[model samples]
Target: MSHSRVNNQPAGQHGMVVAPGGGGNRNAQNMPVDADGRDWSNGLCGCCSSCGTCICATVLPCVVYGKNKHRYQHLDQQGTPEPSPGCCSGSCVAHGIFAACGLGFIFQMVNRGHVRHRYNIKGSGCGDCCTSFWCSPCQLVQESREIELEEQSFGTGRY
Candidate 1:
């Protein structure tokens, strides 16, 4: 049998090598990474950070979930200082329905996303889902702490 060269390309030209953090597709200069992005002020498992929040989340998650939505909406409205929503707000009822079906994680995940977006917190949708699904009460309290901190900083004065 006769030997013949089947491939002509050189081995050295297989691919391009780029340095880490070299403004590649992920961190392109024009993309402008948000320096303002921040970690959650309260850790997911740091329920002890606020005893009241922890208790409320564990005892009445629906209430916490509803209030989180309520407070986030008020914050979105930019200092309107809406009256405090009752514990049985629409969000609470929705949360109760979802929780009854053992699917409250879905609602909590979305709520967590809203919290993340509103505060420019450093987290992804998947992460929020996992955190919310795995430990809902902890996630609720964590979100509660973050929002409460923001409210305080903005002088909302409604804990």
Candidate 2:
């Protein structure tokens, strides 16, 4: 019972210890969006709107998706770094570029979710999964257009 009181502070070597189990940035700001809050085009509406992308999506979906996906990852990379590795995994340009290996939709689907969050698009995880699963190309086109529109309005000049 003769112990001396110690300072109530973390060890100096610990630096800044980020809390585990979701205490950091819950809202991802990697990709900025405009305050306009415009509604997005339907996933199936790419044909009449963006015939070029629609045709490319139909003819060479792999090429179109590969380029776009890689570009998406790069956009995120140029922004604020994620708090943790698991915060975002599909931000690899190389991997996204090779997203034509049939299993790439999994990664693109995840990326789509991030885009939705960035643009404040109202939707459920199940909805994103279904859109990505059914018409991945259309999803890509919609995402690309959304990004372009946001960049144009916000004038981020990053993309």
Each model's Cα RMSD: 15.3, 11.2
lDDT per residue for candidate 1 within 62-111, as digits (tens), equals 99999888877775664443366667789999998988898888989998
Clashes, model 2: 0
| Per-residue accuracy of model 2 over 1-159 as CA lDDT, tens digit each | 333435544442211213222122212233333453324534455554887877776665555555555544444544432222221233444434655455656766777777666555656678778877788778878877665553444344443
TM-scores, each model vs. reference? 0.72, 0.53
**Residue clash pairs of candidate 2:** none
